[model samples]
Target: MLPKLGTNETMPLQMTVGLTYDLKDDYKDAGLDPETIAELDSPATIDGLEAALRQMGFTVVRIGHIKNLTKRLSNGERWDLVFNICEGLHGVAREAQVPALLEAYQIPCTFSDAAGMALMLDKGLTKLVLQNHDISTAPFAVVRAQADIDGVSLPFPLFAKPLAEGTGKGISPLSRIETHQQLREVCTTLLQKFAQPVLVETYLAGREFTVGLLGTGDRTRVIGIMEIAITDTDGLYGYNNKTDWFDHIQYKLLTLETEPALFKSLCTLSVQAWQALNCRDGGRLDIRCDETGQPCLMEINPLAGLCPGFSDLVVLAEMAGMSYQALIENIVNETLHRYNLPQPRQRHEAA
Candidate 1:
């Protein structure tokens, strides 16, 4: 804890929270790749998150970019903290840029630090870290160009995607390839398109799940485990499908009554990944079962989407008995506690 609130403050202390995210603009007209734009936030995600913070009694400040944030702070503006969700536009460390900026100024912020975010961006690097910790992840390789395809050690039915992308970018039904020709063509396409090394992994054809986590260490808990089922058997939970999830995706809450051992295993794997990554505040861990039904980590979203009405994070949160407001408030409260800052008081009237 850095400092606590006191003195002549009335109506509880107010903390200025700078809400930040990358918005998907009219990129297609700009000739920007729409596939890359899918990772950016929707208007609903930004609006709903902003509304949640204001409802929690914090003074909300809209900070959209690192340059803008710096200019404002230099012009005598101050933000007690930043609510960062910037899934940056370039480089492997793009996700780390804003958090690194805030840290340099000694300003507290939400979500993981720069290193953690950077690690989470690269699928191959994240898997390496997991392997170092003796965690189970599907065997994977990185292909930077056409030459690398011939060296792939993984067998057929391999999954390929951009090494550092989220929101299902570089992932589609075509990502699952069964032959070396398919692999070569897909790898070449992804390399040229995404302009990043492509990660090729053994495809786990079993059940897929995503688990939500909150807080840190002993306080950390699994919020809920939700399985995404694709309505179209030929489709995947890819960018196209995830974007229009209403018509194609179904979210199932894993219950002990129905899943029993699988549910428990999912939760366990999620928490282990959370701890391994040294994740802070809120996060989402995606997993898929191996041929033996053992869980394997797919990806980690430390800056999990908070799209309120939609977003799997919201569904998992609601299942854990936490309202949208509570979810946002919980994030603020946990980050505040980490910084030793005074939290907004919860006052009870009459009753």
Candidate 2:
């Protein structure tokens, strides 16, 4: 049995954690565009996570991806908990594939469940849920084809990107459409290139911010808010900007001490959105301001990347004075608390 919290009973075993992820190199020779595999983890990232989990006293097992996991399960293998970050390569429900499988096998995993993952991945679907919950989000439309672009009621000067992509895929300076012709061209290009519906929303002209959050439900709270300032006038913090952020972007950390009203509003809205979507553990919500500077939800990443120095979540955590190991530990502790499992001892404390 797993150890329980608040008890002095000696336990004979440590928790065994299974790690599931998709590596970028796994698909390099598949003749796919770079953006298609942008969300996959680097080998270094998996190695870093394994080292951290071991440092935290958990036996870590590396499970490659959905196919590997399926084979492992067929062999009658299981773990106390799974640290799943598998971003499946197909369908609108790709991100939910691993979690749903684990759910069927009666195994628990970190982060949001299947339903939440599916909803959050599709920008249009997520906005619909946010609208129902009265959360502030930009008006948007999903265009599946050229015919659908004509039906977009949203005004001109809109931004367009793939409906279910992350890591700024299908986004660029041209994403901001100033004319109907531009809109059609951009949407058509994205539709053909990604083979997915496109999401076109009103262009948020003010500043952009991404809030880092932790915990579950009512316990969810903002860890930090980092403003993404683009140095180039035409930059949109899209694929190019994100890929070369050091040269074209500036990250300004915000806090209640610096911007009290804005900070509180962002925190409140972020937590409300997190709960409304039933998201658990830790993640991030991207918010950008309208012309009037009111923050609006752009998208939610329940499975935020964990590539240590490269991921935005880790960068924000460092800005908030949290070490990489501490950020991982906090996520693990929150998951453990949610599952009613005893959290491991802190690395600095006596064993």
Which candidate has the highest TM-score of all? 2
Tens-digit lDDT string for candidate 1 (123-223): 89899989898777999999988999999978778999999888788787789999999999999999998899999999988788888888876667787
Please identify model 1 stretches exceeding 4 Å from their true place: 1-12, 26-31, 346-351
RMSD of 2: 2.3
Q: In model 2, where is the ten-residue run with the lowest total lDDT?
A: 3-12
Which regions of candidate 2 fall more than 4 Å away from where they truly are? 1-12, 348-351
Query: How high is the CA lDDT of each candidate model?
Result: 0.82, 0.89
Taking the tens digit of each residue's C-alpha lDDT, what string does model 2 give over 129-154?
99999999999998988899889988
Q: What is the lDDT of residue 40 in candidate 1?
A: 77
Error of 1 at 300 (Å): 0.5
lDDT of 2 at 188: 92
Model 1 pairs in collision: 1-340, 2-340
TM-score between model 2 and native: 0.95
